[model samples]
Target: MAQPPKGTYEVIHQPNKLKDLVGGPARMDERLIAKAEAALADAVSKIDLAETAKDSIVKLDEAVERLQAEGAEPAGPERTIYTVMHDLRSQGASFGYPMVEKIATSMNRYLELGEPGQRGHNDADAIKAHVDALKAVVATKMKGEAGAIGQQIVAGLYKISRTKSK
Candidate 1:
Protein backbone atom coordinates (compact mmCIF):
# COMPACT_ATOMS: atom_id res chain seq x y z
CA MET A 1 0.00 0.00 0.00
CA ALA A 2 1.13 3.52 -0.79
CA GLN A 3 1.02 6.28 1.79
CA PRO A 4 -1.17 9.27 1.07
CA PRO A 5 0.12 12.86 1.08
CA LYS A 6 0.54 14.30 4.57
CA GLY A 7 -0.32 17.86 3.77
CA THR A 8 -3.74 17.83 5.41
CA TYR A 9 -6.64 15.79 6.68
CA GLU A 10 -10.40 16.05 6.56
CA VAL A 11 -12.21 18.23 9.07
CA ILE A 12 -15.25 16.88 10.89
CA HIS A 13 -17.63 19.65 11.89
CA GLN A 14 -20.44 17.38 13.08
CA PRO A 15 -19.24 17.64 16.67
CA ASN A 16 -19.03 21.40 16.43
CA LYS A 17 -22.28 21.83 14.56
CA LEU A 18 -25.29 22.55 16.70
CA LYS A 19 -28.00 20.57 15.02
CA ASP A 20 -30.91 21.74 17.08
CA LEU A 21 -30.15 19.46 19.98
CA VAL A 22 -32.13 21.82 22.15
CA GLY A 23 -34.85 24.32 21.42
CA GLY A 24 -35.04 26.08 24.73
CA PRO A 25 -33.11 26.88 27.86
CA ALA A 26 -31.61 23.95 29.63
CA ARG A 27 -33.67 22.37 32.40
CA MET A 28 -32.34 20.91 35.61
CA ASP A 29 -34.05 19.16 38.46
CA GLU A 30 -33.20 21.57 41.25
CA ARG A 31 -34.74 19.30 43.83
CA LEU A 32 -32.55 16.40 42.77
CA ILE A 33 -29.47 18.56 42.78
CA ALA A 34 -30.27 19.95 46.18
CA LYS A 35 -30.98 16.50 47.53
CA ALA A 36 -27.72 15.15 46.16
CA GLU A 37 -25.79 18.06 47.61
CA ALA A 38 -27.42 17.47 50.99
CA ALA A 39 -26.46 13.81 50.79
CA LEU A 40 -22.86 14.73 49.95
CA ALA A 41 -22.71 17.10 52.88
CA ASP A 42 -24.06 14.41 55.17
CA ALA A 43 -21.51 11.90 53.94
CA VAL A 44 -18.71 14.40 54.27
CA SER A 45 -19.82 15.26 57.75
CA LYS A 46 -19.75 11.62 58.78
CA ILE A 47 -16.22 11.04 57.53
CA ASP A 48 -13.62 10.19 60.15
CA LEU A 49 -11.54 13.28 60.57
CA ALA A 50 -7.79 12.99 60.49
CA GLU A 51 -6.04 15.08 63.10
CA THR A 52 -2.90 15.20 61.01
CA ALA A 53 -4.51 17.41 58.40
CA LYS A 54 -4.30 20.39 60.73
CA ASP A 55 -0.71 19.77 61.60
CA SER A 56 0.18 19.28 57.99
CA ILE A 57 -1.61 22.50 57.14
CA VAL A 58 0.50 24.37 59.65
CA LYS A 59 3.61 22.91 58.08
CA LEU A 60 2.26 23.71 54.66
CA ASP A 61 1.85 27.32 55.73
CA GLU A 62 5.43 27.44 56.89
CA ALA A 63 6.65 25.94 53.65
CA VAL A 64 4.73 28.48 51.63
CA GLU A 65 6.20 31.23 53.77
CA ARG A 66 9.65 29.87 53.05
CA LEU A 67 8.83 29.81 49.37
CA GLN A 68 7.79 33.40 49.62
CA ALA A 69 11.07 34.35 51.23
CA GLU A 70 12.93 32.41 48.55
CA GLY A 71 11.22 34.48 45.85
CA ALA A 72 10.68 32.33 42.76
CA GLU A 73 13.66 30.05 43.02
CA PRO A 74 12.26 26.56 42.82
CA ALA A 75 14.14 24.33 45.22
CA GLY A 76 13.79 21.64 47.89
CA PRO A 77 11.52 23.58 50.21
CA GLU A 78 9.24 24.70 47.39
CA ARG A 79 8.97 21.20 46.05
CA THR A 80 8.21 19.87 49.50
CA ILE A 81 5.43 22.42 49.83
CA TYR A 82 3.94 21.51 46.48
CA THR A 83 4.08 17.83 47.36
CA VAL A 84 2.19 18.53 50.55
CA MET A 85 -0.28 20.57 48.57
CA HIS A 86 -0.79 17.63 46.25
CA ASP A 87 -1.48 15.34 49.18
CA LEU A 88 -3.99 17.78 50.55
CA ARG A 89 -5.62 17.92 47.17
CA SER A 90 -6.33 14.20 47.30
CA GLN A 91 -7.00 13.67 50.99
CA GLY A 92 -9.05 16.66 52.00
CA ALA A 93 -12.10 15.65 50.01
CA SER A 94 -12.04 12.19 51.49
CA PHE A 95 -11.75 13.45 55.05
CA GLY A 96 -14.79 15.72 54.92
CA TYR A 97 -12.55 18.71 54.38
CA PRO A 98 -13.46 19.56 50.84
CA MET A 99 -12.30 23.14 51.40
CA VAL A 100 -8.83 21.86 52.03
CA GLU A 101 -9.05 19.80 48.88
CA LYS A 102 -10.31 22.74 46.87
CA ILE A 103 -7.70 25.18 48.11
CA ALA A 104 -4.93 22.63 47.74
CA THR A 105 -6.09 21.72 44.27
CA SER A 106 -6.08 25.37 43.29
CA MET A 107 -2.61 25.90 44.72
CA ASN A 108 -1.34 22.80 42.95
CA ARG A 109 -2.85 23.99 39.73
CA TYR A 110 -1.12 27.35 40.14
CA LEU A 111 2.21 25.69 40.84
CA GLU A 112 1.73 23.37 37.90
CA LEU A 113 1.22 26.25 35.52
CA GLY A 114 3.28 28.93 37.20
CA GLU A 115 6.73 28.22 38.51
CA PRO A 116 7.78 29.55 41.87
CA GLY A 117 11.12 31.34 42.61
CA GLN A 118 10.62 33.08 39.25
CA ARG A 119 7.98 35.55 38.14
CA GLY A 120 7.36 35.38 41.82
CA HIS A 121 4.82 38.01 42.71
CA ASN A 122 1.66 36.69 41.10
CA ASP A 123 2.31 33.06 41.88
CA ALA A 124 3.30 33.94 45.41
CA ASP A 125 0.22 36.01 46.00
CA ALA A 126 -2.05 33.39 44.48
CA ILE A 127 -0.42 30.63 46.43
CA LYS A 128 -0.79 32.71 49.56
CA ALA A 129 -4.46 33.13 48.78
CA HIS A 130 -4.93 29.38 48.61
CA VAL A 131 -2.86 28.87 51.69
CA ASP A 132 -4.86 31.44 53.59
CA ALA A 133 -8.07 29.80 52.50
CA LEU A 134 -6.78 26.39 53.49
CA LYS A 135 -5.75 27.78 56.83
CA ALA A 136 -9.30 28.94 57.35
CA VAL A 137 -10.66 25.56 56.30
CA VAL A 138 -8.37 23.61 58.59
CA ALA A 139 -8.75 25.97 61.50
CA THR A 140 -12.49 25.97 61.17
CA LYS A 141 -12.50 22.19 61.30
CA MET A 142 -14.04 21.78 57.85
CA LYS A 143 -17.34 23.43 58.43
CA GLY A 144 -19.70 24.77 55.74
CA GLU A 145 -17.12 27.41 54.91
CA ALA A 146 -16.24 25.88 51.55
CA GLY A 147 -18.98 27.74 49.79
CA ALA A 148 -19.11 30.98 47.80
CA ILE A 149 -16.07 32.41 49.56
CA GLY A 150 -13.92 29.60 48.26
CA GLN A 151 -14.98 30.26 44.69
CA GLN A 152 -14.41 33.95 45.21
CA ILE A 153 -10.95 33.27 46.54
CA VAL A 154 -10.07 31.20 43.50
CA ALA A 155 -11.50 33.78 41.18
CA GLY A 156 -9.47 36.54 42.78
CA LEU A 157 -6.35 34.46 42.64
CA TYR A 158 -7.02 33.59 39.02
CA LYS A 159 -7.45 37.21 38.19
CA ILE A 160 -4.19 38.10 39.88
CA SER A 161 -2.38 35.30 38.07
CA ARG A 162 -3.83 36.26 34.72
CA THR A 163 -2.98 39.88 35.13
CA LYS A 164 0.60 39.54 36.33
CA SER A 165 1.78 35.95 36.20
CA LYS A 166 3.29 33.99 33.37
Candidate 2:
Protein backbone atom coordinates (compact mmCIF):
# COMPACT_ATOMS: atom_id res chain seq x y z
CA MET A 1 0.00 0.00 0.00
CA ALA A 2 1.18 3.51 -0.82
CA GLN A 3 1.86 5.82 2.07
CA PRO A 4 -0.33 8.85 2.34
CA PRO A 5 1.17 12.24 1.48
CA LYS A 6 2.30 14.30 4.42
CA GLY A 7 -0.69 15.95 6.09
CA THR A 8 -2.98 14.64 3.37
CA TYR A 9 -6.23 12.82 4.15
CA GLU A 10 -6.01 10.37 1.28
CA VAL A 11 -4.24 7.49 2.96
CA ILE A 12 -5.55 5.01 0.40
CA HIS A 13 -7.45 6.55 -2.46
CA GLN A 14 -8.84 3.44 -4.09
CA PRO A 15 -12.26 2.34 -2.92
CA ASN A 16 -12.22 -1.12 -4.47
CA LYS A 17 -9.05 -2.39 -2.86
CA LEU A 18 -10.07 -2.19 0.79
CA LYS A 19 -8.19 0.95 1.75
CA ASP A 20 -8.90 0.58 5.42
CA LEU A 21 -9.40 -2.70 7.23
CA VAL A 22 -12.09 -1.90 9.78
CA GLY A 23 -14.14 0.47 7.67
CA GLY A 24 -13.96 3.04 4.89
CA PRO A 25 -13.37 6.77 4.98
CA ALA A 26 -15.98 8.77 6.83
CA ARG A 27 -17.06 10.50 3.62
CA MET A 28 -18.28 7.24 2.16
CA ASP A 29 -21.37 7.40 4.31
CA GLU A 30 -23.09 10.26 6.10
CA ARG A 31 -23.95 8.18 9.12
CA LEU A 32 -20.41 6.88 9.38
CA ILE A 33 -19.02 10.38 9.12
CA ALA A 34 -21.28 11.67 11.85
CA LYS A 35 -20.49 8.71 14.02
CA ALA A 36 -16.78 9.22 13.56
CA GLU A 37 -17.18 12.88 14.46
CA ALA A 38 -19.06 12.02 17.64
CA ALA A 39 -16.50 9.41 18.62
CA LEU A 40 -13.68 11.86 18.10
CA ALA A 41 -15.47 14.47 20.17
CA ASP A 42 -15.95 12.02 22.99
CA ALA A 43 -12.31 11.00 22.84
CA VAL A 44 -11.22 14.64 23.03
CA SER A 45 -13.50 15.28 25.99
CA LYS A 46 -12.10 12.24 27.78
CA ILE A 47 -8.46 13.11 27.15
CA ASP A 48 -8.12 15.57 30.03
CA LEU A 49 -10.14 13.33 32.30
CA ALA A 50 -7.88 10.39 31.52
CA GLU A 51 -4.76 12.53 31.90
CA THR A 52 -5.86 13.78 35.29
CA ALA A 53 -6.50 10.23 36.37
CA LYS A 54 -3.09 9.18 35.13
CA ASP A 55 -1.41 12.06 36.93
CA SER A 56 -3.07 11.10 40.16
CA ILE A 57 -1.95 7.51 39.78
CA VAL A 58 1.58 8.65 39.07
CA LYS A 59 1.57 10.86 42.14
CA LEU A 60 0.31 7.97 44.22
CA ASP A 61 3.06 5.74 42.90
CA GLU A 62 5.64 8.40 43.63
CA ALA A 63 4.32 8.82 47.14
CA VAL A 64 4.57 5.10 47.71
CA GLU A 65 8.14 5.14 46.47
CA ARG A 66 9.04 8.04 48.70
CA LEU A 67 7.51 6.36 51.74
CA GLN A 68 9.42 3.18 50.98
CA ALA A 69 12.64 5.16 50.64
CA GLU A 70 12.06 6.82 54.00
CA GLY A 71 10.68 3.78 55.82
CA ALA A 72 7.39 5.61 56.37
CA GLU A 73 3.79 4.47 56.00
CA PRO A 74 2.55 4.57 52.42
CA ALA A 75 -0.21 6.97 51.42
CA GLY A 76 -1.51 6.97 47.87
CA PRO A 77 -3.95 9.12 45.95
CA GLU A 78 -7.56 8.47 46.84
CA ARG A 79 -10.01 7.01 44.31
CA THR A 80 -8.42 8.48 41.18
CA ILE A 81 -7.87 5.07 39.66
CA TYR A 82 -11.47 4.07 40.17
CA THR A 83 -12.66 7.27 38.59
CA VAL A 84 -10.46 6.66 35.58
CA MET A 85 -11.69 3.13 35.23
CA HIS A 86 -15.27 4.29 35.35
CA ASP A 87 -14.65 6.90 32.69
CA LEU A 88 -12.91 4.44 30.43
CA ARG A 89 -15.70 1.93 30.84
CA SER A 90 -18.31 4.47 29.90
CA GLN A 91 -16.23 5.69 26.99
CA GLY A 92 -15.78 2.21 25.59
CA ALA A 93 -19.51 1.63 25.71
CA SER A 94 -20.09 5.04 24.25
CA PHE A 95 -17.69 4.33 21.41
CA GLY A 96 -19.36 1.00 20.54
CA TYR A 97 -17.77 -2.46 20.56
CA PRO A 98 -19.64 -4.39 23.20
CA MET A 99 -16.59 -6.56 23.75
CA VAL A 100 -14.41 -3.65 24.69
CA GLU A 101 -17.25 -2.19 26.69
CA LYS A 102 -17.56 -5.41 28.63
CA ILE A 103 -13.86 -5.49 29.40
CA ALA A 104 -13.89 -1.91 30.58
CA THR A 105 -16.90 -2.57 32.75
CA SER A 106 -15.18 -5.52 34.37
CA MET A 107 -12.06 -3.46 34.98
CA ASN A 108 -14.11 -0.62 36.40
CA ARG A 109 -15.81 -2.95 38.80
CA TYR A 110 -12.44 -4.30 39.86
CA LEU A 111 -11.15 -0.82 40.48
CA GLU A 112 -14.27 0.15 42.38
CA LEU A 113 -14.04 -2.59 45.00
CA GLY A 114 -10.62 -4.14 44.77
CA GLU A 115 -7.86 -3.64 47.32
CA PRO A 116 -5.73 -0.51 46.95
CA GLY A 117 -2.86 -2.24 45.25
CA GLN A 118 -5.28 -4.17 43.08
CA ARG A 119 -6.91 -0.97 41.91
CA GLY A 120 -3.55 0.50 40.96
CA HIS A 121 -2.51 -2.60 39.07
CA ASN A 122 -5.87 -2.87 37.32
CA ASP A 123 -5.78 0.79 36.39
CA ALA A 124 -2.60 0.31 34.39
CA ASP A 125 -3.93 -2.86 32.82
CA ALA A 126 -7.20 -1.20 31.90
CA ILE A 127 -5.36 1.65 30.22
CA LYS A 128 -3.40 -0.75 28.09
CA ALA A 129 -6.49 -2.76 27.20
CA HIS A 130 -8.49 0.26 26.15
CA VAL A 131 -5.61 1.61 24.10
CA ASP A 132 -5.30 -1.67 22.27
CA ALA A 133 -9.03 -1.80 21.61
CA LEU A 134 -9.02 1.67 20.13
CA LYS A 135 -6.05 0.85 17.96
CA ALA A 136 -7.75 -2.26 16.61
CA VAL A 137 -10.91 -0.36 15.79
CA VAL A 138 -9.02 2.32 13.90
CA ALA A 139 -6.41 0.23 12.13
CA THR A 140 -7.95 -0.45 8.73
CA LYS A 141 -11.11 -0.48 6.62
CA MET A 142 -12.92 -3.35 4.94
CA LYS A 143 -12.86 -3.88 1.18
CA GLY A 144 -16.20 -4.31 -0.61
CA GLU A 145 -18.01 -4.15 2.70
CA ALA A 146 -16.45 -0.95 3.90
CA GLY A 147 -19.47 1.26 3.41
CA ALA A 148 -21.89 -1.15 5.02
CA ILE A 149 -19.66 -2.03 7.94
CA GLY A 150 -18.72 1.58 8.52
CA GLN A 151 -22.35 2.63 8.57
CA GLN A 152 -23.34 -0.13 10.92
CA ILE A 153 -20.50 0.37 13.32
CA VAL A 154 -20.89 4.12 13.40
CA ALA A 155 -24.60 3.91 13.88
CA GLY A 156 -24.17 1.41 16.67
CA LEU A 157 -21.62 3.59 18.36
CA TYR A 158 -23.85 6.62 18.07
CA LYS A 159 -26.73 4.73 19.56
CA ILE A 160 -24.61 3.58 22.42
CA SER A 161 -23.35 7.07 23.04
CA ARG A 162 -26.79 8.62 22.91
CA THR A 163 -29.05 6.00 24.45
CA LYS A 164 -27.30 3.17 26.25
CA SER A 165 -25.11 4.93 28.84
CA LYS A 166 -24.50 8.44 29.98
Candidate 3:
Protein backbone atom coordinates (compact mmCIF):
# COMPACT_ATOMS: atom_id res chain seq x y z
CA MET A 1 0.00 0.00 0.00
CA ALA A 2 1.17 3.50 -0.79
CA GLN A 3 1.05 6.10 1.98
CA PRO A 4 -0.43 9.59 1.53
CA PRO A 5 1.98 12.50 1.40
CA LYS A 6 2.34 14.56 4.56
CA GLY A 7 0.42 17.92 4.63
CA THR A 8 -1.87 16.70 1.83
CA TYR A 9 -4.70 15.28 4.04
CA GLU A 10 -7.55 17.40 5.44
CA VAL A 11 -10.27 16.69 8.06
CA ILE A 12 -13.74 18.23 7.75
CA HIS A 13 -16.69 18.40 10.20
CA GLN A 14 -20.30 18.40 8.96
CA PRO A 15 -22.99 20.30 10.89
CA ASN A 16 -26.31 18.61 11.68
CA LYS A 17 -29.06 20.23 9.63
CA LEU A 18 -31.83 18.95 11.93
CA LYS A 19 -30.11 20.29 15.02
CA ASP A 20 -29.62 23.64 13.38
CA LEU A 21 -33.34 23.71 12.41
CA VAL A 22 -34.27 23.13 16.06
CA GLY A 23 -31.89 25.94 17.13
CA GLY A 24 -29.10 23.48 18.15
CA PRO A 25 -27.90 22.30 21.61
CA ALA A 26 -31.14 20.26 22.04
CA ARG A 27 -32.48 23.09 24.22
CA MET A 28 -36.23 23.75 24.12
CA ASP A 29 -37.99 27.00 25.00
CA GLU A 30 -39.74 26.79 28.40
CA ARG A 31 -42.62 28.96 27.23
CA LEU A 32 -43.16 26.74 24.21
CA ILE A 33 -43.01 23.62 26.41
CA ALA A 34 -45.56 25.10 28.82
CA LYS A 35 -47.88 25.93 25.94
CA ALA A 36 -47.51 22.43 24.54
CA GLU A 37 -48.28 20.89 27.93
CA ALA A 38 -51.38 23.04 28.31
CA ALA A 39 -52.54 22.03 24.87
CA LEU A 40 -51.99 18.37 25.68
CA ALA A 41 -54.00 18.67 28.87
CA ASP A 42 -56.80 20.31 26.95
CA ALA A 43 -56.79 17.58 24.34
CA VAL A 44 -56.70 14.83 26.96
CA SER A 45 -59.59 16.42 28.83
CA LYS A 46 -61.65 16.36 25.66
CA ILE A 47 -61.09 12.64 25.20
CA ASP A 48 -64.38 11.01 26.16
CA LEU A 49 -63.60 7.42 27.07
CA ALA A 50 -67.28 6.67 27.58
CA GLU A 51 -68.13 7.57 24.02
CA THR A 52 -65.21 5.57 22.66
CA ALA A 53 -66.12 2.62 24.88
CA LYS A 54 -69.69 2.74 23.71
CA ASP A 55 -68.49 2.58 20.12
CA SER A 56 -66.26 -0.33 20.97
CA ILE A 57 -69.18 -2.12 22.63
CA VAL A 58 -71.21 -1.71 19.49
CA LYS A 59 -68.38 -3.15 17.44
CA LEU A 60 -68.08 -6.02 19.89
CA ASP A 61 -71.77 -6.78 19.59
CA GLU A 62 -71.54 -6.86 15.83
CA ALA A 63 -68.47 -9.04 15.93
CA VAL A 64 -70.06 -11.43 18.43
CA GLU A 65 -73.10 -11.73 16.25
CA ARG A 66 -70.91 -12.45 13.29
CA LEU A 67 -69.00 -15.02 15.30
CA GLN A 68 -72.13 -16.84 16.42
CA ALA A 69 -73.64 -16.72 12.97
CA GLU A 70 -70.46 -17.73 11.18
CA GLY A 71 -69.52 -20.38 13.71
CA ALA A 72 -65.87 -21.04 14.60
CA GLU A 73 -64.17 -21.36 11.26
CA PRO A 74 -60.49 -20.58 11.28
CA ALA A 75 -59.84 -17.02 12.41
CA GLY A 76 -63.03 -15.50 11.05
CA PRO A 77 -65.04 -13.47 13.55
CA GLU A 78 -62.88 -14.43 16.48
CA ARG A 79 -60.10 -12.42 14.92
CA THR A 80 -62.42 -9.48 14.56
CA ILE A 81 -63.51 -9.73 18.19
CA TYR A 82 -59.92 -10.01 19.31
CA THR A 83 -58.88 -6.99 17.29
CA VAL A 84 -61.63 -4.85 18.82
CA MET A 85 -60.95 -6.08 22.33
CA HIS A 86 -57.25 -5.52 21.85
CA ASP A 87 -57.84 -1.90 21.01
CA LEU A 88 -60.10 -1.47 24.01
CA ARG A 89 -57.58 -3.14 26.27
CA SER A 90 -54.74 -1.00 24.98
CA GLN A 91 -56.48 2.37 25.21
CA GLY A 92 -58.46 1.90 28.42
CA ALA A 93 -55.75 2.79 30.92
CA SER A 94 -54.38 5.67 28.84
CA PHE A 95 -57.89 7.12 28.77
CA GLY A 96 -58.32 6.73 32.53
CA TYR A 97 -60.51 3.61 32.39
CA PRO A 98 -58.56 0.79 33.94
CA MET A 99 -61.72 -1.33 34.34
CA VAL A 100 -62.22 -1.31 30.62
CA GLU A 101 -58.64 -2.38 30.17
CA LYS A 102 -59.04 -5.15 32.75
CA ILE A 103 -62.21 -6.56 31.17
CA ALA A 104 -60.75 -6.42 27.68
CA THR A 105 -57.58 -8.09 28.91
CA SER A 106 -59.64 -10.98 30.34
CA MET A 107 -61.59 -11.33 27.13
CA ASN A 108 -58.41 -11.31 25.07
CA ARG A 109 -56.97 -14.03 27.28
CA TYR A 110 -60.11 -16.14 26.98
CA LEU A 111 -59.98 -15.85 23.23
CA GLU A 112 -56.39 -17.00 23.19
CA LEU A 113 -57.03 -20.15 25.24
CA GLY A 114 -57.76 -23.64 23.97
CA GLU A 115 -57.98 -24.21 20.25
CA PRO A 116 -57.52 -21.30 17.90
CA GLY A 117 -60.94 -21.52 16.24
CA GLN A 118 -62.89 -23.78 18.53
CA ARG A 119 -65.04 -21.48 20.62
CA GLY A 120 -67.79 -23.42 22.40
CA HIS A 121 -71.32 -22.33 23.31
CA ASN A 122 -70.09 -21.51 26.81
CA ASP A 123 -67.36 -19.44 25.26
CA ALA A 124 -69.93 -17.29 23.60
CA ASP A 125 -71.66 -16.77 26.92
CA ALA A 126 -68.39 -15.75 28.51
CA ILE A 127 -67.80 -13.23 25.75
CA LYS A 128 -71.27 -11.83 26.21
CA ALA A 129 -70.59 -11.43 29.89
CA HIS A 130 -67.44 -9.51 29.12
CA VAL A 131 -69.25 -7.26 26.72
CA ASP A 132 -71.94 -6.64 29.30
CA ALA A 133 -69.34 -5.76 31.87
CA LEU A 134 -67.76 -3.30 29.47
CA LYS A 135 -71.15 -1.71 28.87
CA ALA A 136 -71.83 -1.45 32.58
CA VAL A 137 -68.49 0.15 33.28
CA VAL A 138 -69.05 2.77 30.63
CA ALA A 139 -72.67 3.38 31.61
CA THR A 140 -71.68 4.04 35.21
CA LYS A 141 -68.65 6.10 34.18
CA MET A 142 -66.46 3.89 36.32
CA LYS A 143 -62.87 5.09 36.48
CA GLY A 144 -59.59 3.73 37.82
CA GLU A 145 -60.09 0.47 39.80
CA ALA A 146 -63.53 1.76 40.80
CA GLY A 147 -63.02 0.64 44.42
CA ALA A 148 -64.54 -2.61 45.72
CA ILE A 149 -67.33 -2.98 43.17
CA GLY A 150 -64.91 -2.62 40.29
CA GLN A 151 -62.59 -5.17 41.80
CA GLN A 152 -65.48 -7.60 42.17
CA ILE A 153 -66.57 -7.05 38.62
CA VAL A 154 -63.11 -7.65 37.20
CA ALA A 155 -62.54 -10.70 39.38
CA GLY A 156 -65.89 -12.21 38.47
CA LEU A 157 -65.23 -11.74 34.77
CA TYR A 158 -61.79 -13.29 35.09
CA LYS A 159 -63.30 -16.26 36.91
CA ILE A 160 -65.91 -16.69 34.22
CA SER A 161 -63.26 -16.54 31.54
CA ARG A 162 -61.15 -19.16 33.29
CA THR A 163 -64.10 -21.50 33.79
CA LYS A 164 -65.26 -21.07 30.23
CA SER A 165 -61.82 -21.60 28.76
CA LYS A 166 -61.46 -24.86 30.66
The residue pairs found clashing in candidate 3 are none
User: In terms of lDDT, which candidate is stronger, 1 or 3?
Assistant: 3
lDDT of 3 by residue, 1-166 (tens): 9987987777788878888788847757999899999997787689888887677788888867765664445356667778888998877867789999999999889988855467654467788888889988889888889999999999999998787656
> Can you list the residue pairs that collide in candidate 2?
20-140, 20-141, 21-140, 21-141, 22-140, 22-141, 23-141
Q: What is candidate 1's lDDT per residue for 1-33, written digit by digit as tens?
A: 999978988877575334466745555789989
Please identify model 2 stretches exceeding 4 Å from their true place.
Answer: 1-78, 115-166
In angstroms, what RMSD does candidate 3 have relative to the true structure? 7.8
In order, the Cα lDDT scores of the candidates are 0.66, 0.44, 0.81
lDDT tens string, model 2, 12-93? 6556655466475644788888999998888755553333334533543453344335333322422443454456556545
- Model 1 / residue 4 / CA error / Å: 21
Off by over 4 Å in 3: 1-39, 70-74, 114-116, 120-122
| Global Cα lDDT for candidate 1 | 0.66
Span of 10 residues, lowest total lDDT, candidate 2: 137-146
Indicate the TM-score of model 1. 0.58
Evaluate residue 84 in candidate 3 and report its C-alpha lDDT on the 0 to 100 scale: 86
Q: What's each prediction's TM-score?
A: 0.58, 0.29, 0.71
